[model samples]
Structures are given as C-alpha cells and as structure tokens.
Target: MIKTRFTEMLGIKHPIMLAGMNWITTPKLVASVCNAGGLGIFASAAYSPEETRKHIREIRKLTNKPFGINQILIGPGAKENIDVAIEEKVPIINYSLGKPWFIDQVHAYGGKVMGTIAIARHAVRAAQLGCDMLAVTGHEAAAHGDVATSMVLIPLVASQVKIPLIAAGGFYDGRGLAAALVLGADAISMGTRFILTQESLVHDNFKQLCLMATEQDTLYSDVFDGMPGRALKSPGAEAMMKKGFSLLQSVKSALEVKRMLNLPLWKFIGLSWSMLKSKEGKGLLIQARSATGAISHLKAINEGDEKEGFLFAGQSVGGIHDIPTCKEVVERIVDEAEKRLKAVGKNVSA
Candidate 1:
C-alpha cells in the first residue's frame, strides 16, 4: 500500500480521502470509503442537527473504521451539528470557510480537526490554529475553490506547513495520487472521481454527463452559489450564469432552507444574523444564493433534472469513464501509485 502521514495519522490503510461533497457524501458512501481503507468524510452541511446525529450513528453501524464529518462553519446548524459529532466522539471533524473554535473540544476527545483551505496563506493560518491536518483545495476542484491550481498550491502550502496535507482538486487516478505525493501532499482527496463510483448515489443521468465531459466542460462563476465555484457545463448552470443574482428567488430558496433544517422562524433569523456577523461576513445575499444552489443540487442528485439542476464537478471528470466499486477504485489507485513511484525512481537513477 502507498502509505503516508495521512494514512498513519488517521489509522487508515491508504493515503486517500473521499472529499466531502454536500448532499453527495451520505452515510453509505462514507462507510464504503472507510471500509475500502480510505478516509470517508460525511458531509454534515446538508442535514439538520438531528439528521446529522442519526447519520453519524448509521455510519458507525456500517463501519468501525475511523471516519470524519465535514462541516461548513459559516452556515446555520454548523455549531449544533458539530456538537452532536463531538458528543458522539467522532474520529475526525473537518471544517471549512471559517475558523474552528472547537478544535480543543475535538482534541479533548482524541479526535483530529482537519481544516480545508483554498489559499496558501490560509494553510499557514489553519496550521497555527491547531488543525491536525489540512485539505488544500485547488481551483480545479468541484464546488468552491479560489485562484491557484493544485500544481502551484500544493508545493506552496507544503513549504509553509509542517502538518500532513491532503491535496484536493483535479485528482482522479493513480497518476494523480503519485503526483500529489511528489508535490509534498500526504494524500489526495477525490470528489469528482468518487462521484462516478458504483457506491455513489448521484443520478445516472448526471453520471453519464460527467463521463462525456472534457476538461473544458466546466464553468467557474459566482452564480453557482453566490460564491466562486466550479460546476459542470449544463443548461441549468449556463442559465444561472445568464440570469445572475435574483433577490426574489433567493428569498424563496432561503425559506425552503429554513423548512429543511426544521428551524423556527426566529431561530432561522438568528442564524442568518449570526452568519452575517461571523468572521467571514458572507451577508444575506450569499446565504440566499447558497439556499438556491442547495435546492438545485438536490434536484440534480435526487431527480436528475438536467435543465433545472447542475452538479459541481472538477476538471478530473474527463479522466473518469467507468462506474467501479469504491474498493476497486481505491485498490486500483494504490496499485498504480506504487508502480508510478517505482518508475519515477528508476528514471532518476537512469
């Protein structure tokens, strides 16, 4: 097996991770990854606190291996959901978008906190904040990513931080895994690649679309979720880009979010105000757009509504063409990485 600090730190057999894709990384998918020897991160941002607890228990029933939950710290229910995870003594808690104040709480229970960062400077800040590890996202990633690609971002962050680094974005196969290690990452996180697996719950229609996509088939824009992100070039995605921000749609979408989370009107308002005042200071418009994006994301995953829905995808979609089992994907990547590494060693000697 191709072991690295990521594998040793997490007590997993492989230095691979299932990137947390909101709504896509369900209990089953997470468990499957853990069982396959890679770290699976349950996406807690899509569910309420109660739902989060239920799913955490469900994953436990499915696998005894170490696993994690990924939370977007700037949103509502983030604190509540994270509280539930800590109460359950989860193995790892991964967060993004904002600072993690509960690092000590997690570490108190012997759980590790992984910070996800898109910027090189943010990697340094996260390391300083006691993050046990960092998931460095590049611009080629699915969902939210900033300006730098993995090529520039990985080595840059590696030079700045001493903690284990998980390279995310544009990674698909063994070659990519080998390259990530060579670039100084401890492991590689794959979202788009895992989404094509048989264990994934993504609609077959969207899977087919991903198979047909080229590296150029993605569009990056703020319209996807009011924050800059990358998504597959679809009719819904294109329409959103043309339509721009819509206040009316955002209000309607925010209401849907409130109902989905089972939050009372006052509580929902409080959360909204808190988000605005948070360190990120995303404001109401961004939250509203995020609501709209969440609904569309559900449509794409649950109903496969291509015209009205869009799925976040990375440039690596072009390299994925088959729907293999999670175990097969993991094993294949490890085998390929080993061979590639040996080949590189031979070349150096030659």
Candidate 2:
C-alpha cells in the first residue's frame, strides 16, 4: 500500500472512505468499514439530532476505531445535527452546501473538517475556510453534485487547494483508486460501490438491480427528487418524467417532508426566508426545497414501494452484483488497490 498522506492524516490504515448516503449508511455499516481499516461515514442529513446521536452511539458500541459523520450543512436541522456530532465527539465531520462557519468549532475539539465539492470555486473556498481536507465529488456521484466529472475535476481542484483531497464518484475497484491517486487525491470516497454491501441498508432488490445494470443505466434528472441527481430509473422516475405526473409526486413528497421537518408552514416559510438571504445558503435551501421526492423515496428503500417511489443510485450500480458485508466491501477495495498500486511500481509515480 502507498500509505500516503491520507492514511497518516486520518490515522487509518487504508485511504478509502464510505460516502454518506442518507438512511442507507446505518451504524452497523459504519462500524464495519472502520473495523476493516477504511473510513465509514454515517449520513446524518436525514436524521434528527437525537437520531444522529443514537446512531453514533451505536457505531461507538460496535467499534473503538475512528469513523466520521456526513452532514448536509444546509439541510433541515443542520445546525442541530452539527451540535450532536460535536457533542458526541466524532473524529471527523464531512459536510457540503452552505457556509462553513462551524469549522472553527470542530477544530477546537481536534476534529478535522472534510468539505465535499465538485466545482473548482467551491473547493478553493473550502480550503480557505480552514477545512482539513476535501472530498471532490463529481457528476458520477449518486446524489446532488455539479457537472464536473471526476476525470476533470479531481486534478483541477488538487492543483488549486492546499489540503488533502479525496475523490468521490464512480470509484469501485483498485484501478479507480489508482486513477484517483493519479488525479492527485490522497484517498477515494465511494458511494454506489459500498451501497451494495450486505451491511448497507439499501434494499436487496435494489442491490441486485445495480449489478444487472450497465453504465448506461443511470441518468441525471430532477424527476426523482426534484433536484439534479443520479439514480436507477424505475416506474416512479419514468412517470415523473411525464408532464404533470411529477406534480403529484411533488405534492405527496412535500407532505412527507413537512412531517419529517415538523414544520407547520409558518415555521417552514420563515426558515425558507432565512436560507434565501444568503447566496450560498439559497442554493442549498433551493435544493432542499425541491427535495420533496427524496423523503418519499425512503419509503421505496425501506418500505418496498419500488414502482412508486424514488431509489437513489449511481452509474456505478452496473458494476455491483453481490451484497457483501461493509467490511468485505471495504476490504476488497483496499486489497485490490494495494495489488494494483504494487504492480504499477515506479511508473505510477506518487
């Protein structure tokens, strides 16, 4: 293994990361990745502060090794979630969207902040904001990200930012990790690859579907969750593509969002106004505002609504075939990456 800056910086044995996918990254999954020497992140964006802490406690129970928490800094209850992470003393905080005013707070406790970005300007801003590292997610990532592909964005951001960079999007095998390293990232963050693992909470049917898919199976559309995202196109997504069909999904999704946020219109509208006041804040707020279908999509994931709800996935699904445990998944990637890196020798640089 290269044992590059990433491993030393994070005090982990491998330079691999589990990208946070809401609801799908449960405590059991997080512990598995950490135990295997790769960093696993729990996605707390979909949870209330209490729930976030609950999951963190569970992860701690499973492993004493370090793990991270991924939070959407502008999502509903973002501040509260941050508070919970800090209070629980997580080793790392991974975040994206909105101002990074909480960086100082995280640093105070010796916890590092890893800001995720796809575009160049955002990466520069993150570096300037005192983030300890960066996770540059590209178009191939499962959820919301800018148009830049990992091939183009990775090196570009690396050239501009001084902090360590972790590449996300379409990373599965060792060659992908080598490619990420060649592009100037110290580590690689994976989403779709790990989502298929047995430890992941993604539906078993969905995991099988990913393996059967091809690179062409995925697409970027606002139909599934209203904001631009990549996913497997099911009947619900196709129906949403039809004019006026999405509006109904929109209505149904909004009802669920309100219930989840516990907002009673007046409070929701007030928070909306606060988010719109700042340019960066507005972008995140607008995305979340359009995320009506996202809340409903979870129903598809956990409740088996398959044909009627959204299922967020990446273009990488085509490469997934079996549902291995999270440790097996991370271990396989690390093993493959080490073999690939070792075989490449000096020509691979580093």
Candidate 3:
C-alpha cells in the first residue's frame, strides 16, 4: 500500500486528493472519494453560507470518513464560508487566491489549513504562516497556474519547506502519483480527471470535449478572470481572446455575481474592498476590478454554452478518456502506483 505524509496526516488510505473545482466538486463527488479512501474537497467558493452548511451536512450523511472544504480566500463570502467550516469542525480546510487571515482560528479548533500555491515563494510563505500543508500547482493546471511546471515547482518548493506538499498540474494517473513522490511531493491533486468521473455533475458535452482534447487543444490567456489562466479550446474562449477586455461586459458580470450571492450592496462593497487589499488582488488589480469571469464560468460549466461560456480546464484533460466512478478511479490509481513502484524496486535490486 502507498504510504506518505499526506495519507498519514489525514488518516486516509491513499495519498490522493480531489481538486476543489467550483461547480464540479459537489457533495456526491466528495463523499464518493472519501468513501473510496481518498480525500475529497468540497468547493465552497461558489456557495452561500447556507448552501455550504447544507453541502457539508449532506456529505456527513453520505460518509463518516474524513473530507475537506476549499474556499477562495478572496471571494465575496469567504469569511462566511470559513465560519461554516469551522462551525462544522471540518477535518480539513483548503484555500487559494489569497493569504489566509484566520489561520489561528482554524488551528484553534484543531482543523488543518492547506494553502495552495503556484510558485516557490508563495509555498515558503504559506509554510511560514503555519499552514499544515501545501498544494503546489504547476503551469499545466487548468485554471490559474504559475509559470513553472509540476516537475520544476514541486522539488523547488519541497527543498525549502519541511511541511508535506501536494503536487498539482498535468497529473492524471498512478504513474503521475509515483513521479510526484519521486519529486518530493507527498501526494497528487487532480481536477480534470475527476471532472470526467461518472459522479461529476458537469454536462456530457463538457466531458466529451475533455475526452477528445489534445495537449494542443488548450490555450492560456488573462481574459477569463482578469488573470492568466488555461482553458480548453472553444469558440467562446477564442472569441474572448480576440475581443480583448470589454468594460461593459465586465460590469455586467460583476452585477451578475452580486445577484447570485444575494448579498446586500454594502456587504458586497466590503467584500470587494477586502479583495482589493489582498496581495493577489493588488498584483492583479485590473483583474480584481470586475467579476465577469465568474459569470462566464457559471454559464459554461452549468449551461454548457461553449460559444459564450468560459470553461477553465487543465492540460491533464489530454490524458483522461474514460468515465469511471469515483471509487473505481481511486482504486485503479492506487493499484497502478503499487505495480509501478514494485517494478522499479525489482529493477534496482536486479
């Protein structure tokens, strides 16, 4: 059996984690992964405080095994969602997009906080902030990614931090997990591969696109969320690339997010101000100015309107082809990793 700091720390059987992709990592998917011995993380960025509670309760009902919640630190309802997780005393709390402000609070309740970073410097900072663990994302990641690939970033950050690290980007199978361990990561986190699973609620059209996609089928641009990100090749994405930024469209999207959150106007403004002050927001000030990307993402993932919606995808889509259940996926990955590891050991002994 595969053993690593991630598995030991989380008390799970395998060192695999499901990426918390908004609109994709539903309660059903999370429970399935937990039941299958892998960690499943629920994406709380798109959920209201009440919705987050409901999802957490649903997962509890489905499985007594451990699970986690992922929250975007810069989202409008980030604090609210975090409160829900803390109140629920979740086993794990995963966060990205901004520095965690309530790390002390989370730790006070015996909850672990994992910070997701794309670059080496951020990994060091996260470790310094007492992050229990880190998920280092490479450039081949679907949505927001850094310039370095997993091959380069994982070891680079691992060398600097003693905390357990999880590698992301362009990882789809057991071979990838084995390779990540070799590069100093304790586990691997995947988003694209999980999206194609039978339990994922993503429309079939989106799944088909990922199945048929090639490495060259994805393009990177700053058009989606006002920051650099990767997405599958589609007419809508292409059009956005060509059209450049539109002030009117951006404003419209921001309004749409406000309505979807159902937040009071003053509350919305306060959230916007908090985001603006964050290091991530300050670095990408223009991108943080509007919420158009949120609208596009909802449309694409939910409506499957490829012509007008934005679908954030990772390059790992190129490696996935089957629609297996979550249990099948986890078991297959662990089995393959064992096979590959044993083969390597035999070769070295011989």
* Per-residue C-alpha lDDT of model 3 across residues 1-350, encoded as one tens digit per residue: 89999999989999999999887899999999999999999999888899999999999999998899999887588889999999999989999977788789878988889999998998999999999999899999988888999999999999999999999999889999989998999999999889889999987777888899998889898888787899988888888889888877776667677788788989877777776676777532443433777777777888888888878889988889899999899999988988988888888953
> For all the candidates, what are their Cα RMSDs to the real structure?
0.9, 2.4, 1.7
Which residue pairs in model 3 clash with each other? 142-313, 142-314
Error of 2 at 54 (Å): 1.3
lDDT of 1: 0.93
Q: Assess the local accuracy of residue 41 in candidate 2 as a C-alpha lDDT between 0 and 100.
A: 93
**Which candidate leads in lDDT?**
1
Model 2 spans with C-alpha error above 4 angstroms? 243-252, 263-266, 281-291, 346-350
- Candidate ranking under lDDT, highest first, comes to 1, 3, 2
Clashing pairs in 2: 198-324, 211-320
Among all windows of 10 consecutive residues in model 2, the one with the lowest summed lDDT is 243-252
**lDDT string, candidate 2, 164-226, tens digits:** 999998888878988899889999998888877777777666666677878888768766554
* Cα TM-score per model: 0.99, 0.92, 0.96
Reference-based lDDT, residue 33, model 2: 87
